[model samples]
Target: MFAVHRSNGLRFLRSGTRTAAFQVRHSSTFAVWNPPKQAPREVPTPLVLCSASHWDSGTRNNIPQIFATMLAEKGHTCIEVDFGLPGDGEMCSSSQDLMDRLSEELKVNLHLSGSPFPPVIFARGFASLIAQAYISSHPAQGLFLISPPPSNTSLFPSILPTPLGEFDYELKFPVAVMACPTEMVQLRKHSRLGQDELVDLIEIDNLEGRDAFLRIEQWLDELGI
Candidate 1:
């Protein structure tokens, strides 16, 4: 359970005394966390950015925060951004516009971390599209997409339907997709991206807390991160 409160246009959610939280807002609300400043550095530390349409601005309904904290515990700096509510601008934006804005946000976060290697992107639900588009233009160190739609058309009606095969062309870095049994079936059937040489598929009932974090660390270790 998480307690939610708001102050200074930022929301706070406390799962317990140990979960460090900080929130900032732009066109979207971004919650960021890192290991304590005094903590020893993790060589080649990961910069993780998470987003999910199902999440709200606070911990009470925050999938992003859960994922963020989990990654932070693994010695990565994590940031979660909520792009308003689900379906907010899904109706009007062309694929080009979506890619442009997504790339901008990614660049900003990348600069903030200033990591020599590209950051790992973690996205769920509708936010997976944003992760996909960003990876298309800017190769990441890795990508972990949770519960992404099987098709671009299913993801957003405004964009033309495209097979996952085409998206895989842009993914030169390591990638992983985690989805529930039902969504995983459709994703595997429709998206050829999951079959790429650099891609791995993980089936999980839900990606939260310690298990998810351990899996991510294992994946990153294999990638030599």
Candidate 2:
């Protein structure tokens, strides 16, 4: 059963499978119940940055902090989740667990915080798969890949046991891939991703020894994000 009060001084009532309408009139001073207005939706905070390090390196190597600092300077919140290792044993299991948590956190925070802001995953080397797999299942607003190696490369072959051909599944959002000139050449030959799949393809002159964080910042500016 349901009842609705109409503005024309009428009350509509529905009982079981029957509907009835009645008019309720009173003096001009008679008070009437009014539905409360819904609160406005809140704007979400800045992106939650997920930073992953190389396969063999530890998170304490300062790489995550460096990137976080760079983003922080631009008024973005960056969170680092360290997968720690690349092998198929403890590190792999731990990384998979972290991915699950990230998905859960994004869901919970978005609802409880009353914000729709989505996160962006930034990964390098072997930990890139952790980001990719998480995004594949949970989906994010954006993805940023830096110097990602081929799925079968020596550095992190086991990181993505699946062949590149199998990654034909469409992603839910935009991706930005930044690779060194050398790495870009290799990626074009072996990677399943193409320019069309990415929002932008950035080529860096030197990635092995140089800091190309500024390029990422510039790209973000271009996006007006």
Candidate 3:
């Protein structure tokens, strides 16, 4: 059993290294993920981290927003982190350096949330790559990768490091991969980690709409997270 919240209060954080924003959303209110941290308070939701494709790109559908809301409604603090990749204006010398910066900021936020260590993180695409890089060395409650990229994509070497070739996340904690029909094959072909035992692969025709949520929710139920 975890801290289950049925409250309507939701808080989202969109943060950068030096700049941070906060927003608290109640029913019928529009909220931005990267709002200034001075919003009116309500019942606090449990805190969890979620990373999505840059700028809500339609390439992966709107699963990012859906995932955030689903967790928020259940009393989890659904923080939507807008992280940047190597060429996405994230001025870092290498992937490891970027991960270190993010890791530091995450630890600080974890302390502020009063949540347990090794948080459950949901990440997608390039964000998923970064998430894996973080979890490889850190302990985590769970890892959910949405539409993950293969380890050996033609473009990966430009952004990722060599040591991540093995990935080996399954040895650290529970891992899951949620992919649409389009991305599922490549995941199995190039990224063997998406295998049944190593990682739970929930294949969907499309990673949008209500059906996608139900499948992902079912997996969470199975994991008891």
Candidate 4:
């Protein structure tokens, strides 16, 4: 049993047995209600925008898919897109053009959801370069790059478009990297890799199964996402 009284732009709630005061602030379109002793529920995980080598289902592998699947299992809404470079005869300009398209898609999705929070971008291999480019203008909660392609390897030589140091990456928000020890070493050659500006480097080989999930969750926790 409770009673609510409204007067002078304020609402007061009084329980029959126990009287408790509540403050309600009214606005043009909504009201802000603050209740006491409300139990916290599970919050929907921050949306994750994932990208890999290509968009086609047939050409795709299971690597980036695994990340999206795992993130979904952890309660995140993961959207996977293909920002990979076209393999000749493709109409798209590949990198920049794909990122612009992705940015537009993200804006549309966020608007439709009506959520003020922005989604984090997750990229694997060469697609990380695209993610880095997108986050420069459009703000995001975070950026996670897994196993970004090495600069000079047995398969490709001088393949990286722009060096990591040259990329216009925003250091305001957190940026995480999950790569092999050798890959991290390779990245250090191009970028001034260190533990600053909310940048974290995790040795992917060190994380396995539940441990990997926990590490990412911990990062989100620290960021208050």
Candidate 5:
């Protein structure tokens, strides 16, 4: 159960280093965890794409799940894309056709609903490739990559498949890469996300920990978006 509390007509929910104030309502069964103070600061919608094999099945304490729970606790909904493994047990062929189709799927399905504030995209696994394909060209408030595969690597075998080269995208927004120690090494050796301006490379011991989420919140504060 949530450790929810109310005081002086304001409902307080704890998330990371900040507390979000939800509107006090007695009759509603469900209350949105939107922060009242963030209204003026523009809290962008949390857009997440967790690459995995049926992660939302209520079985694992994965990073995406943890992040989603934190969002739920704070009265924010996580808009996520479910990209699971192929049923046939075979990766798709690396081809331009596949990239175009997935790109279209991402564009059509994901909507910018935060109104005047753009979304901060959070992508992991092969979904990171899809997000990269779009965000490299389009605009966003920020991009948070969680344990992404080496850039230009054939993660799904269709979009920019094969280890083409080091990542060389000229991103227009801030970026944060949260990786485990091993992932940190791989990413440092193969990606340019850490070296770029306004990009942060964070090493996390446990992705499901409050500390990791807190670091991200601090990064968001730095972004001021």
Candidate 6:
């Protein structure tokens, strides 16, 4: 899914004897569509829901049947893959490896494994940092960070991991962030910078142990799903 064209001052990374840079021609903005239907309407793209709390992609609790039911009701196709560690029958590896594997599996050129989707939504903060590093190497269309920990140490108390490197968040795309007030404060203070940054932070009250399915539904509705 990548192409190599000679460009000035462009150093191509070599994998084996072939050198290439990853690139995908993003189609014009389009909306998601429900399945078993004929025409594609103006709806958000299919939500590749990532798991949360170190759970595998196929874990029932990670996705919650309710969320699936709601998405089905809305007619949007939800493809939930197991992005967690191995031993669960899903592809098990580091966040970067998993991302590369996922990109190949999904037949997309974008790098998604190292973004906030897997770590914040599935593996917590430290895992998210690993994901961030991967994204830095491979770019993606959007990002979604859900209820990240205050610090990497808070999530992984035994090992203190380093923060992710700098990133450009000015790309023209929609970034949706959902977090509890407390988590939001911590993320704002540590992770997210200005209000006008890459993502539009949506702070929800009473998020402690709250079901995210309903929130996701509401989010889709607001987006005109």
Cα RMSD to the true fold for all candidates: 4.9, 19.2, 9.5, 14.1, 9.4, 13.4
Ranking by lDDT: 1, 5, 3, 4, 2, 6
Predicted structure 5, TM vs. truth: 0.65
Worst 10 residues of 4 by lDDT: 24-33
Q: Which model is ahead, 3 or 6, in terms of lDDT? A: 3
lDDT of 5 by residue, 1-225 (tens): 255443336455566534433332221111233333443343456544444333223334256545755664554445444443332444556534344455445554454223344567777765666677667566677888887776655343453443344345677788889888998898887677755556788998887688988987788678764
Per-residue lDDT of model 3, residues 46-76, tens digit only? 3244453442354654455566655544434
Number of clashing pairs per prediction, in order: 0, 0, 4, 0, 1, 13
Best by TM-score: 1
Query: Over 4 Å off in model 5, which ranges?
Result: 1-46, 52-61, 85-95, 112-116, 154-167
Question: Candidate 2: where is the Cα deviation over 4 Å?
Answer: 1-54, 58-61, 85-116, 152-166, 194-199, 208-211
The candidate, 3 or 5, that scores higher on lDDT is: 5
Cα-based TM-score, every candidate: 0.73, 0.57, 0.67, 0.60, 0.65, 0.50
lDDT: worst 10-residue window of model 5: 23-32
Q: Give every collision pair in model 5.
A: 33-75
- List the lowest-lDDT window of 10 residues for candidate 2: 27-36
Compare candidates 2 and 4 on lDDT and give the better one: 4
By summed lDDT, the worst window of 10 consecutive residues in model 3 runs over: 23-32
Per-residue alpha-carbon lDDT of model 1 for 50-69, expressed as tens digits?
Answer: 56433322323356677666
- CA lDDT, candidate 6, residue 117: 31
Candidate 4 structure quality by residue, lDDT tens digits, 90-150? 4444334545555554444345444466767666665565566667778888887766554
Superior by TM-score: candidate 1 or candidate 4? 1
Between candidates 2 and 3, the one scoring higher on lDDT is: 3
Point out the higher-scoring one by TM-score: 3 or 4. 3
Alpha-carbon deviation at 201 in model 6, angstroms: 1.8
